[model samples]
Target chain A: MARTLINLPKTAKAGAVIEIKTLISHPMETGYRPGPEGRLVPRDIITEFVCRFEGEEVFRAELFPATSANPYLTFTTLAERSGTFTFTWTGDNGFSQTESAALTVT
Target chain B: MRRALLGLLLLAVPAAAEIAPGERRSGFDQMTPELRAMQTDEAANPGQLWVGDGEEAWAAAPPTGRPACAGCHGAVATMRGVAARYPAWDEAAARPVDLQGRINLCRTRHQGADPLPFESRPLLALTAAVAAQSRGLPVAPPADPRLDPARAEGERLFTRRTGQLDLACAQCHDALWGRRLGASTIPQGHPNGYPLYRLEWQDLGSLQRRLRNCLTGMRAEPYPFGAPEYLALELHLMRRAQGLAIEAPAVRP
Candidate 1:
């Protein structure tokens, strides 16, 4: 399970590109860090992220071990109409999270 | 340029009898350039989320009959430079009060609203909002004579070793400053970037939270939140950080 935050403008002009910011809390363990007993911490991180607006794909990204903890992603998409924007993240250890926010284009 | 020359002069003219010089550099100065850049970019700093929430909270009236903070204060911009002068001596209370205490005082006395718990999200948000208003202002606690006793007590507490590890705040933050403690460098331990978003915490937190973490690391029992000891320590820390720019809602690793 992951804690997520999604930021989207409450309203935007029709056809205007609006910025969307999302942050997910994940350790993004690189597997290189040493644990208390000198053992390597297991690697875990969100590997894929996808965003959809009005059921249509808008943005996508592939994350890696090099990604920092609490991965933050910001992107812009054209606001076509008043609708919901959905975000999904999948990663190691069978981790997955989904969150959505509503936006209105006046 | 003149400030740099003054700094050099101060360094050259050291006096054993003079009071210890305050830290000139901020913890932000020790950060990697990329991390520094993130803090500089308001859009990128995660702390801004709480600040945004704080802005809303300032305008929202609770169940109490009193008006919202915005109703009285008008614009948040007017609050600029206010946080930098906190831990001020409250004559009515006859003691020093930090920003958090001041907020709670307003809530109970003026708004008739119950005081928010320390470290609570609502409290942190409001504190962050007030602190955000003072961003970039120099930390300048009032020069009230009554605070001297508490300042001295705080200074003693800072140097007096305690806890299972027998460590004091000065041990790592002062004597070992600029040295590496594992992957992180020991900072001068100023209170400038309070209510900052520490990546280690993965959320916005108060200075008290950080201090508690330190005490825990030392195997020391932490004082309950809002304890007078913490306020005294805060007053001392603020004085130590005098002239340092406030970077509230700052980001850190």
Candidate 2:
């Protein structure tokens, strides 16, 4: 499986804002480059990345070939309730990966 | 006459030309300071993702397998010196095999499981993980008289001109080492930090993937995965990387 990494605060106060970071290993092949035979390399890149906090959508991104490989994203979200934060990355070539982390609001 | 003379000169030089100890350096030495900074930091380096996954895979049996790798290997720490000694002669296969190939062999033969596809994420992850244990250890491929032929074949492949570009691996990597190839610096073509993270690739990949990329860059035909040529090339490259510290799960641009 493509490796995914996430950073989340272990503890946060209710109603306080928290930062989240995510990175995944992927080639994000742009399809523009030529192969050994001068044929165009097929374009394959992460097309969408979404993050949900406590089952509510908090951050999302539409990725493209221009996006760097191993897409890294940082965003802020409110620690409304102690719950699960689920992140999903969808891309070309049937590539889809999901990761989750727990946040405790004290 | 000139072409023959050039060939003669090339033949006079050993393909496995040794760099003096004082002068030998890994490709990482040629990177810009900023990239070096990123590669050196575990938190910033993306190769950690695969390393992490590799940690997970080590403990868990494949979906169908009865034995996990940890069943016999004990602790991951025991594997520290293991990766540095691979691309060794596999008596059963009667050929040289790298860490990845060895892992697949164990999976299929010992684990009673299907082998992961070459360049697949699971394979790359596991390879990175195994290699990570050897981080900072010097590479020391075992010396065996039986492997001499494979090593020689690898040297020939390294020095042979290929593709429309008609370039040999020695030209850009050896002759142009530390020089600029457009925006990027040419590396000495070491195989230490394989299953490495390439910013251009945006994903972790095997040494074979990188080799294929180079072939594409040269506008040359790439051999199929698991081909003897790649194994031979890997054998040759690992020797070239001798004495360099293992830095698997390394980051590259």
Candidate 3:
């Protein structure tokens, strides 16, 4: 299930400022419920998120226990470089998700 | 300003008893024997946290020097038949008393302890134990005319219009019977087995709790805890499910 929404600006100037936002829907449960085997479910959550442009890391975040269920993020970026920006979420239980969008600098 | 204030007021009511999230799952008619067995096991085990507390309440004598129903009633079996006949006409009081009221009476008059809050753990457990005693007994409303008024009140609540959803309680549970609202299916809304541990909630909740869910599902402002409206509805639904087995801790989507 793709939890995030990615919206790219239609176009951008070479040095123009650009904004991007993302939101994901998840319970992000605290693993408080005992599993079928009576063992507490491991704390599998999105602990890391990274956004990169043209192979350069533009933004990074380290999530903690307090991060609420539906996480949302917005940030400003420069259109000085034109290429694809990739977003990824990494966590326990091999949970991984990736999304990408392209920008053209003129 | 008037419109905005009205909207805010409307929002406040729904906010109090809002369903945590998502739609109430439907399709509850499909239950296998394995699922039924699982339900039995869950019910047999003491309810999470609450049951243990109730056991303590029952065994410990209060300082007020009131008689202990426990010393006489002993276990649920002794009082099971009593519940199935409740909200009945008490010729003495000449008015109806729901289970919560009755529990309060015992605590205040006989148990020597203060009455627990309507939706609190102690109250729920006491009600649970008392209601459990009537496990196999059929719901039998008192034949006296006194109950007619309360039952009429409940029926009115079930059909009343409310909320942004523009729904009445029966519009779905009664009119749309056997329909799917989302991932889960809906069954005939019955209260035979309450204090149920619904799978969707992943916790044991009272029928009133479920009513809160319904009010939220329909986007209506829910009545406050221990509200008269909810008690009336409870009485009505319990009577409706009269012939059905009391299946507390029952699983629902």
Q: What fraction of the correct interface contacts does each predicted structure contain? A: 0.04, 0.58, 0.00
The Cα error of candidate 3 at residue A4, in Å, is: 41
Better of 1 and 3 by lDDT: 1
The residue-level lDDT of candidate 3 at B80 comes to 65
Q: State the weakest 10-residue window (summed lDDT) of model 1 chain A.
A: A1-10
Q: Output the better candidate (1/2) by DockQ.
A: 2
The per-model lDDT (C-alpha) reads: 0.85, 0.86, 0.67
Candidate 3 chain A has its poorest 10 consecutive residues by lDDT at A21-30
- The chain A TM-scores for the candidates, taken one by one, are 0.95, 0.96, 0.83
Residue B106 local lDDT, model 3: 74
Estimated TM-score for each candidate:
0.74, 0.76, 0.59
lDDT of 1 at A56: 92
> Candidate 2 residues B1-253, lDDT tens each?
9999999879767643545455668888887798887787775678888888888889997767577999889767788888898888889988888899999999988888889999888898888889999999998988887888988898899888999999999888777787888988888889989889887776788989899999999999898888889888888888888899998888788
In model 1, how large is the Cα lDDT of residue B191? 90
How do the candidates rank by DockQ, highest first?
2, 1, 3
For model 1 the local lDDT of residue B224 reads 87
Cα displacement (angstroms), candidate 2, residue B186, comes to: 1.3
Tell me candidate 3's interface RMSD.
Answer: 16.8
lDDT assessment of candidate 1: 0.85
A1-106 in candidate 2: lDDT tens per residue?
6777788898999999998878887877889989999999999899999998777899999998888877778899888788999999999989888899999989
